[model samples]
Target: MKDGRHLVWILDDEWNSHELEKSMYNQHGFEVKVTRSDKLEDDMPLYAPCADGVVAQVGFQCRADVIDKLQSCKVISVSGAGYNHVDIEAATQKGIMVSNVPDYCAEEVSNHTLALILTVTRRLASYNRKVREGKWDPLDTMPIHRLSENTVGLLGFGRIARMVAAKLKPFGVRILVHDDFVTEETFNVHGVEPVSLNDLLQQSNILSLHVPLTTETNNLINYERLKMMPRGAFVINTCRGGVINEADLETAIKEGHISGAGLDVLEIEPPSPDHPLLKMDEVFITPHSSYLSEESIDELRTRTTQAVIDGVHGKHLPYALNQVKTETKI
Candidate 1:
């Protein structure tokens, strides 16, 4: 392990995130390069030094086509909670250990979820819009609801979902979770009742989606699923945009099947100005900032560094995308 030439690359969009990453790697005696850009076509020039090990804040696709351009990329890490941005299967095939710093922002994101729920439920955005538009009497026409004694259905029972459950406990809300990965031991530990998807939709007063976006999970909450939900039920999506099916959600909201939505993500990041969801008074959005906060950033940086170290050392990594361990475990 002595005198190994270490290089870490950050392909992300945070303006000053590079400095923090550089400082961490510099202290550890590793050469670091941070290429920050929001526009892919314009920013390609900045990431010219992308070397052996790559750590990304939000994974940008690193296909074998571009991996062909990269001389040495031993490992790839997603800096945020989600890994869907990375072509995981592609990276795994290239023998690169793809990992994620998943748990660092669990509470922060769950908090954002609740914020969205409260904001939309209370018509915070609608009220703000009316106030800004100089309509003092719009409150009379606003549709608002109370959060007390409601049933909250979760799409997944991951760390973030569990955090949401814990936070909602004091609201006298019943927690109904659905995750094939969650076991009975977890149920006994948390006192959260496991329910099927259909049951969650049929009984929940507030349906919050927390599942990651994947091939099988894409459009998971389509038109049919939305119809199953109780009329006037609120939907909060702190999870992925693709899972809910943008078209289906827009229709559901338009049809008044769902009362409101608190969305932190969209079908496209930084959705176009003309996006219909942006104009909906019943919808509240936050530019995918659910996983962002000062406290979370500090933890994200530290966890990202450790994931890189673990990936390089050929040890187990948290949320590894590569099937190396699955293919060969001791």
Candidate 2:
């Protein structure tokens, strides 16, 4: 929309290279400029504000102050499913569309979710530690339950959660879900039982959180909620870390009420070395890698660029998260 070409600013630090984005934008007659700064407020130059579109990564927060500086920005394409990093309200008010690639890593994340479930349920990590410590006895970690006997509860029924349900079907485990937004027909189609939040907390033998982090969901699984689960219940979270109160989780685990947990994310990224959960043998942690895969990354980049392209051309944004009016068009 500027200088006879669409201008895109890549404000991201997660990826190693912007060659993919640059190539994609260049093919569409667009000029792409990248700022590999994780913190835009401290690092972005003032002249960088005149972008027609933006491609953002999780590490960069496009807050109200930052969004206000984008004088010509028509759209912002977040490179991943979660758009929590972007100030959606500010963008909408500024007539800038916000889009996210929600389905790009569905398979990868679902696979990681199932893997974490199995790792905790089967006591794989505990046994592995024992074996390494020269303890060679299966009874060292007994009471391993069959996956079919344990009820697996999914916190949300979005694309990733539904894919998880489909993957869990062949395992024959009873799946319970608690998402007020999801209809009963969705539960029936997936052969999952729809339950109230209280029931979900009380009945699930293994609970996996898949909800987004918002005001309502932040610290949703606090001390009281964790206590509601059956004693010795396992917890799995592939979603946002803020959804669970980390301090309360540690207390519940220390009290032996919650048996174990598989966490792909934490309230803090790269948690401190002395973090209580990190030292617990009952807890397993992955470095926020649930959504990683070569194919997934490729798809994410392609879709994210396409979103900006569509937005600058005044076409409907396929993965739009907010409504906005823009004057820029092809």
In every candidate, how many clashes are there? Answer: 0, 0
lDDT of 1 by residue, 41-145 (tens): 454443423456777667366555544444456678788778876777667666677888778888789899888878877778777778889888755655555
Off by over 4 Å in 2: 1-4, 38-43, 326-330
Question: What are the runs in model 1 whose C-alpha is more than 4 Å off?
Answer: 1-4, 36-50, 68-71, 132-143, 325-330
TM-score of each: 0.87, 0.96
Q: Candidate 1 at 184: error in angstroms?
A: 1.7
With candidate 2 superimposed using the best TM-score fit, by how many Å does residue 261's alpha carbon deviate from the native?
0.5
RMSD to truth, every model: 3.8, 1.7
Clash-forming residue pairs, model 1: none
- The whole-model C-alpha lDDT of candidate 1 against the native structure comes to 0.77
